[model samples]
Target: MPSPSLPPELLLLVVEAVLPPNPYQLLPASHISTRTLLALTRVSRATHAQATRLLRQRCAFVDSSRRLADLLLCMPRLVPGLPPVLSLRHLTALYIAPFGASLDDLPTAVWVRELFCEVCETLRRLVVQMPFGSLDPLDDHLSVRRTLRDGFEQLHRLEEFVCVGEYPALSVPDGHTDVWRLWPELKRLVLFGVPMDSHWLWWDIATLPRLEHVVLARPVRLDAVNIKDEYFHKLPREDVRLSRDIKVVLMDLVYDLGVVRTERWKEIDPEEKMTVEVFEVPLPFYGDETPLELVTEWARRGALDGSVWKLDATKVRQEEGSDG
Candidate 1:
């Protein structure tokens, strides 16, 4: 007699193992094809349920105003809404950005806020690159920032949160970020296409005990610096603490027509336990054909060999104690 067929769950697990690239990345390398998923769903009612669950757990989209609007309208038909409300329960990651131009209105849309609210609990990683040249009014920008903070503050276990593009809502006149308080459990944070000198955020970042990597790219002067947190910023008169897990990547934004290649990348330094990939070319949110110098250029001339700067927190602590 022929052997019995395996369980649908087991088969689906096998399929997952065979195609492990994150669906949210939607990279060409991803092996999760629509045809395969369709076959899996048709295998059996059990397979349909499990496959459907997996399908809705990750979201990837090209950041175009039209696409975003269409996606918001289509999400309901695809993902099961969370209880007592309308939201996706299993979604954990999202990557979306406006291609060439910024749709300032898109960030403030009701659907956008609702979507963020819906994924607040389950979202572990988020990438929204509107990067700069936003046309939204200042009030709209502030509103969007507040909404983001509201949504992000609810996320207790979020690990990676990236917000890039024109005047990141996080920026305010006072030099304090609006979202720093919201990221208690975050491990990696990248703020590109903006000015960094004003908002150091050293205190807020170091406090996150789990934080391991940070990438800051300021566009104003095209300044980039990297530092290991074994010694954090010990400003002369502040109570500086220690967070040994930091590895930073810094770069500048430049509009160089001579620069090309979406694949142009650099992993400047590599130590026993630390590595930082400083992009020679920042990923373009617009389609590849768009020739815009909107990236945070690795503006400086150097090997970027992790010898940028250093801060000694251990000595500062000792000095602070002695100041008494």
Candidate 2:
């Protein structure tokens, strides 16, 4: 006897019930049949409306060719209709990489707000990787500021933000300050390859209500003394609320881990609740030592508070070793 054929409605219900919210995984279901998959767009106006929501939930954009057109072409079809089918009610995560300044063409502020509204409403994680050239210092500052302001205005639900990029021409005067003031839900932040005084840039970090993990990689030229003095003199002496949820990691591209670890972070924020961890591996080379030590220390410290800090030294080495 053959298995009885189920009704399309029943199949649709089953598929909708089991479809993981991730877009990468959603592709496999397409193999069952285009009709069955597209049926997702018909289950309800809500699901049809949320097709892009499902797509952006787990999107990845890579720009290996260094060409904006090539990178845009490489985007998966799942993201093609993302701008249209997305809903501001159900978005949770977003990863974006724009090469050759393709993002400059779009109205940065408007686009960012639209995208943010769609994702940050229920978002927990955000990862952004764009080439430095995409941002213009004089011409794009206002737009960038507007974009950031609009994007973060309503993102009270965010937990983590990971940004990786070379030195962009754009500037965010007290940008970190604004982020802390606005995103009360933020908990973890990771930055890579930014050319700024990390210590000065992060002076207002003590204000974050729930920030627990911070990772800085390949900071160009950070001054330990300035950082130490600023934290020691400028920061509050004792804020039980502020001290309990802050941890820091600094990685330099041109120093030894042992040397960087000895920097006077304690002088900067002497609150016994705050812990600073520094690791500097030799430039252009990586060993098991740095990652193992960093992870071990992070786990040891974070475990005490039921949190975790992660550093991927191999990935950092690969990125630095590659010739751009």
- On residues 1-324, what C-alpha lDDT tens digit does candidate 2 reach at each position? 999977656654655554444333312223343344355666554445443344434322222223323323333333333335534345465444443454454444455555566555577765555554555545663465546455666678888766554332233654534453467788887665443345545554656667787766555445432333444444566655544645666665433332232244444444445555555443335455554344333433332222324543332111222221
- Per-prediction tally of clashes: 11, 2
TM-scores of the candidates are 0.61, 0.56
Instruction: State each model's CA lDDT, in order.
Output: 0.47, 0.48
Question: What lDDT score goes with residue 83 in model 2?
Answer: 37
Off by over 4 Å in 2: 2-56, 60-89, 107-109, 132-134, 141-149, 152-154, 167-181, 193-200, 226-229, 252-272, 278-309, 312-324
Q: Which residue runs does candidate 1 get wrong by more than 4 Å?
A: 1-10, 17-35, 60-87, 98-100, 106-108, 131-133, 136-149, 164-167, 171-176, 218-231, 234-241, 251-279, 282-324
Candidate that would win on TM-score: 1
Q: Write the per-residue lDDT of candidate 1 for residues 11-80, one digit (tens) a residue.
A: 7686575344533343211344544654665666556655555554533443565665665665565423
